[model samples]
Target: MSAPVQVGPSSSSGGPAPLEDLEDLLADIGDRVRAERQFRGWTQAELAQRAQLGTVALSSLERGRPTLLSTLVLACTALGVDLAHVMSSDWREPERGPSMTPQQAVVLREAAAGGSLTEIGARLDMTAAEVGSTLTRVYQRLEVTHVPRAERRAAAVRMAVQHGLITPQKRTS
Candidate 1:
């Protein structure tokens, strides 16, 4: 026979009760972690071994026990959760803005041409320091760590397409 379940005292009774909000949050986190681990086909013992943590600690964490930030980070790392995805404030790609000024576009193109920052700046009638600062802001707006050559080309192409600087072509046989 199944044992009878005991219900805890409710908050309405003004007696000691479970912290529902905290409990719910912990339960949600636990559910996510458990689901991810299970989806990866990892048993608690295997996960513990791979994470280099004790099975009991792993179990407690999986069960949503309050754990240290370092412990949680270690566990997440072991589970292949890119900490950057959690820590980054903005992950989504931002909407493209208006095309940059002609001078700015020229500066970007020159930079993309593999010229030194100083050379590009000189060609664009700007100082190397100014060019560096401008590039930093541009990169931040673009949401990329470092612009690749192909990405620079793509940006130029996009700008040209947007400003009617380049005409669309029909496909041919």
Candidate 2:
């Protein structure tokens, strides 16, 4: 993976973004919007209609101008990606992200790979018990708290994949 993009408050600057950073950030966001729209095989006009936005506004946003939150939400919702995912590439926003955290998404993505808790924990650099506890929280959040332990992993994995939170795990050499 490419090195994670640095976003949010700058550690060095720690203050207002210079005009340059602002422009760069907007362009970056616009690129993400464009990519997702294209990946979905959507014409700009099609997404604009779905987002209830004017094609002009969509074009402007794609050009990386700071726009309204409603505009951002409409774009993300149309693309089936999380707003948080756009803000910080680390997280997958599940349909709506209110029910989960970035850390939770990471853990769930790892779990979906099909492994015992111990093995998953080893990969995650956590203890097996941490994996179980984390998954328990995920289940509760997903409202599948009653799903039996035997099936929870598969079920959560399926949920994640269906929500576009994670791709189904694939084996590779």
TM-score against native, each model:
0.30, 0.44
Off by over 4 Å in 2: 1-98
- Candidate 2 lDDT, 91-127, residue by residue in tens: 6534464255677778888887768889989999999
Residues forming the 10-long window of minimal summed lDDT in candidate 2:
1-10
Clashing pairs in 1: none
lDDT tens digits, residues 78-125, model 1?
433444454678656545664455555555556655566798788888
**Pick by lDDT: which candidate is best?**
2
Taking all chains together, the TM-score of candidate 2 against the true structure is 0.44
Point out where model 1 deviates above 4 Å.
Answer: 1-20, 69-86, 89-173
Candidate 2 lDDT: 0.72
Question: Backbone collision count in every prediction?
Answer: 0, 0
